[model samples]
Target: MQSNFSYQTHDYFNFVFTDDGSVGLYNNIVGDIYHSKFGARTEAEEKFIKPLNFHKNFFKKKELNVLDICYGIGYNTKAFLNKILKLKYKGKVSIDILEYDKNLVLISPFINDSYFKTSPDISYILINLLMDEIFNNKEEVMEILYKSDNKKFIEPFYRRLIKKYEKTEYSYNPVSQNKAFLHNIYYHYISQRKKRYLKLPKIENFYVRTYFDDARASIKSLNKEYDIIFLDAFTPAKLPTLWSLDFFEELFKHSSEDCLLVTYSNSAAVRHAMIEAGYFVGKIFDNKKHPCGTIASKNKLLIENKLDEYDLGLLKTSAGVYYKDSGLKNSSQEILEEYSQRRKLLNLESSSQYIKRNKRS
Candidate 1:
């Protein structure tokens, strides 16, 4: 792996500082930020992490499996790692992440640590220590770093191996003790991905595989089942391939019986696609006045918060006809135009009428 990342800055991306003091990439072609302006890290935690109830789930099972789609900037995966460490989970985890753009992963290391910061606890303190050592300096890490144990708390590896500190290097071999340890494991994984398809270097208790190709095609070929699926792809309007009806059907095939598929989308089209694909869809509410995202699961009990009458009505209308990519062979324009023609033929009630009809009197 190379230490110099100066030449890897993507020309198609415009890095913008987000409201949460984190960096977000604005795709020139898509014309949207990779994450919401509310806060990239906060959004991942609230939408994906808390909704999953990872701590409770970790305690119930000796192993955990996750499928993170889009894997943009590695925020969702990094947040998951932080939460698991904070929970002091001692479980073996297998994560298979689908990322189409390799450049996003490459530039993630240079992203400020503020994006990784979360609420501080003893577990979080231990996480801070691991991160501090990984980056070699506390100052270079997140500003939220708290003073805590110097010994690393890498669970499932009870034995602590303390070694004399050495100058921090960005290469694959950063530490002398661990021949494979790098300053940042995720960053190392990205830097080592020199080809379109590459298997990531294994981390203790964590096995991650990155597929650098079209997600629609990749989802079909994946033989493994997922316990949790993170749908973090671009919006249907901007990138419809991943949100098509056909794509969700393929995802359903690869999902476990008890799988919880989560995404930051609450669009009627998105929800309709999930329901049409046989998933029991619900709203991933964070107790805000308005719901945040949607979570789909095989079990209805897993959905504590669900879509209201207005939403359900909207889904039945043309508003929820959804983009179609039959046989997974349609282009974005094709899917968009197909939905447009379908809506015209349905002659459905407007969204406002549905909202008015379902209004809570």
Candidate 2:
């Protein structure tokens, strides 16, 4: 018997604060946590950032373009910023991020700097301040604001910030005293002025554009090449649209010759999709967890410690028969049903058999 107000409160309540002070969400419909219970920021650093080899690669490139997929709460994006800022790279850095859920975007401004205690370098002070004003009247903004409220409030603020700071320049290694070096946030769904590209505020030679559409459709429209691609989407079983072979093909097309894509999933299906989409694949090692992620790149030299023979063997089994969207428009149920039928057609090896074979090999 929860009222509308209660339902709204419930939505906010679903975001639970972790030990690191970073927030994690409970997906009520899915009965799962959006991020790992261990730590959200921790996972972003250990799983995505470290594996990217940013320090080694950033200096070699004149400009670095990043595509952060399903950019939930902007953890991976922020982590990327944290790394590059420390290195003090002077080259142009651009990020094209995708997020389907507007609620997460709306909630982002409310998340204070304290929420990212684990990553103190990524301050959300400006974003939090703006969000505070939007909800100043509380009731009025809440009532008027829905999913579509983005263009009205969010986009304009971002535009103004970028315009205000577009001409500013900085040293390759600027002092920390510069407030402009802190951070700037921008996101969009379309390609305007040759790819809806909006230069990020304060930070010199930085640009960002956000896509509010589903990754499957939006990613295909991307014409620019990227250096680092962070696949921070939901689980493959739950969110198949972003992990499908068709989607990976779009990624491969938009990626630079040496572009490297990282994901916190060691899922065989994801690996299979990446391999099938024409990329050298490898594992992302974590000291706290098992080989916890997969990295894919067009250049074989970029993929350090590629999946060994035993791990590659897993792809031949049922685990490798990844999900497909049948032209990238099928619903999750439809995709699952199709995958189920596909599984039935193959005499795939059981998990135990695969393990036994791997151990023997």
Candidate 3:
């Protein structure tokens, strides 16, 4: 429950401001950032939230269950809460989040921006998690939230939102009032009108349980079936254990029949592994309506865009060779080494070769 790294010193949480003004953490060890530079909140909205079509599907359910793997800073979950709040969804929500680094969970609430500032419900959920899982007392949590340089970190982004809102006319429609609505909330929070501004009743139906452990082990212990699963792991080359066939099989077991497992990875190996795991896989389009990620489910009808011929052909190439973790106990190095050996032994056509052959045909 203790983190040796200090946020003030930028020792562990190497914060980077993304293109969309949201904060992201750079993992020096992984040589990558935790979120996309395109936009952290935007990525979560387009990749994870939009694809699920919660309004047409899950909103009808009396209770919704979600499992989020690799829950770094929880942008995906935050985006989810924003969408549901906008939709005025009343269904009970239960989320099971798995993250190996407790530090990320500890730092999540402090990393603020306009995107998160507007969504008070996210703050509420995150604060509750911090108290329930990280700290035993509310005083410790309040000290971190108020005493830390949180205001300094969020002020610039919050000002930008204010300027944007000032330029636009206020409207009554939800879509049109988005900026104005956020402006009001931000003003309330900054004005220290806590009694009048904080809306606890809005999120009373929301429940979140966070497991600070290896996702491989945590998934095994979860007995509940989830309606939606967000797999936001690192790339297949960087961390192949989570993308392995065995891992997907386990996910397939935990998934409800119509459950959609979404990830921001469009790797051929990752999609092939999902297919082999007995799930119907499809492509997830980005904001521009271009294919950017993969989605898988037990129900074929749930997949809107099925794999086309080119996609199916690519699966036969060397790039389609998936990593294996039979017992889910193998290290990343072991998985990568085993994958290399298997690729060489299979002698499958290279992805370039497949592309060139398709062009000739």
Best by lDDT: 3
Quote the lDDT for 54 in model 1: 68
**Candidate 3 structure lDDT:** 0.77
Candidate 3, pairs of clashing residues: none
Give the per-residue lDDT digits (tens) of candidate 2, residues 302-321: 98978988788889998989
- Clash totals for all models, in order? 0, 3, 0
Candidate 2 — which pairs collide? Answer: 187-210, 188-210, 192-196
Candidate 1 local distance difference test against the native: 0.66
Alpha-carbon local distance difference test for all models:
0.66, 0.67, 0.77
**CA deviation > 4 Å runs, candidate 1:** 1-9, 115-202, 359-361
Off by over 4 Å in 2: 1-13, 112-121, 124-201
TM-score, ranked from best to worst: 3, 2, 1
lDDT of 1 by residue, 1-361 (tens): 1111133324556656667766566777677788888778778888998888765544667777788899867678777777776576777778776876655543343355363333222222223224333445323222211113211211211111112112333332434433334323433433454433323322466766767667776777789888889999888888788898888999898888878898989889999999999889998876575688999987787777877776798898767878888888777777789888988998998787777766744
Q: In model 1, how many backbone clashes occur?
A: 0
TM, every model: 0.75, 0.75, 0.83
Can you write out model 3's per-residue Cα lDDT over 1-361, one digit (the tens) per residue?
Answer: 2211233333444666778888777787677778999788788889999999888878888889999999988888888888888887888999898987765765565566445546665655565545444333323333433444444554444334433433452442344254336536555664474445454534458888888777888898999999999999888898787899999999999999989899999989999999999999999998678988989999999999999989999998999999898788888888889999999999999999999999999
Let me know the TM-score candidate 3 reaches against the reference structure. Answer: 0.83
Q: Is candidate 1 or candidate 3 better by TM-score?
A: 3
Q: In candidate 1, which residue pairs clash?
A: none
